[model samples]
Target: MGTGNTNWKKDFDKAVALHKKAINGDKQAAQKAYETLKNIKFQVNNHSLVEAYFGSSSALIARDSTDLTDKTNYAKRGMKALDQAIKLDGNNVEIRMLRGNVAYRLPEVYFKRTKTAIEDFQYLIKAFEGNNRDISKEQYYEILLKLGASYKTVGNSQRAEETWNKLLSLNNSKYKTLVEKAKSTGGE
Candidate 1:
């Protein structure tokens, strides 16, 4: 096999071992493994490793369960690491999707203070620019759903509705599900 396949197998094996160790309560080993995987240079797609980083960051945030104030910083660090992954391989759909997810989960108050959440969401929009039309459509609807959800969380009901409508226009499977969900919930 070529280097691409070889490196991916190595990363996959390490990721599995790390997750097993984490499940067995080896927190330090788990963290070290996740960091190593995140830093691994792979010719194959590295989206899974990047997502593993997000999972580890989320785990770290959860460990500090008492500190809501610090959770935002945890999210910020995850965003930076995800951004680095995106810089390395910007075309990976999963990386862009995970970046969108990080933006969507951020608290509204913190987002208002620094606007980082909005910037992150905008980055998702930019990530799809100039892709093939079919892929573009799929990503466009995903962004609309995420943006609509974020705006609703932030109390921008009007913008959320607009985004929902744009998503409905695509008539894709997921967007259709979302449109019906919105209608049932009175357009949130």
Candidate 2:
């Protein structure tokens, strides 16, 4: 447990550093934090905490990366971290949500691992189902949108169309056209 605590402290320090860097307009700090967090894969049994850190660090890194190629690689690393966090804490809605989020952002052509994304979305939906009143429809809809996009990217036109229709049923008109277009274009 001493090592676990040490890892936690390290993560906390990195978070503090990231905040300081962002406050000082250090764009690279965020990216650095992501790499640092990735390296800290300290095997936390507490899934929620691990996932929370993973999501926060990944977001910072992904948001800071200027090059598309770099962003994709960083995002992929973030996804792996989040996935492991989820395995340790599969019951956390937030963890599953982060997984869906990372999966959604991965490149379609090169990182066309739609199956992984689909599993994450499935987990998110299952977790969400048990917490409907506690979670906002907007948040759930966002996952659905990303899941649909993932399906489209993997050439599952039917699943994408069905998911898009489900989103529309939830009154998410904002992404309806885009989803429909993707469905029609067979995800390009």
For residues 126-171, write the lDDT of model 1, one tens digit per residue.
Answer: 6666553334666677677767777666667798788788778766
lDDT values for all models: 0.59, 0.66
Record all residue pairs in model 1 with backbone atoms less than 3 Å apart, i.e. clashing.
Answer: none
Alpha-carbon runs more than 4 Å astray in model 2: 1-29, 32-48, 55-73, 132-134, 181-188
lDDT of 2 by residue, 1-188 (tens): 22445656666576657745743557677656655554555544444545556565665566577888777766666666676776777767766665666566666576665677788787776667877554577777877877777887887768877887888887656777766776676653
Q: What's the TM-score of each model vs. the native?
A: 0.53, 0.68
Give the worst 10-residue stretch by lDDT in candidate 1: 111-120
* Residue 186, model 1, lDDT: 45
Which segments of model 1 are wrong by more than 4 Å?
1-9, 12-73, 83-94, 110-129, 133-140, 172-177, 180-188
* TM-score, model 1 to reference: 0.53
Clash count, candidate 1: 0
- C-alpha positional error of residue 177 in candidate 2 after TM-score superposition, expressed in Å: 4.0
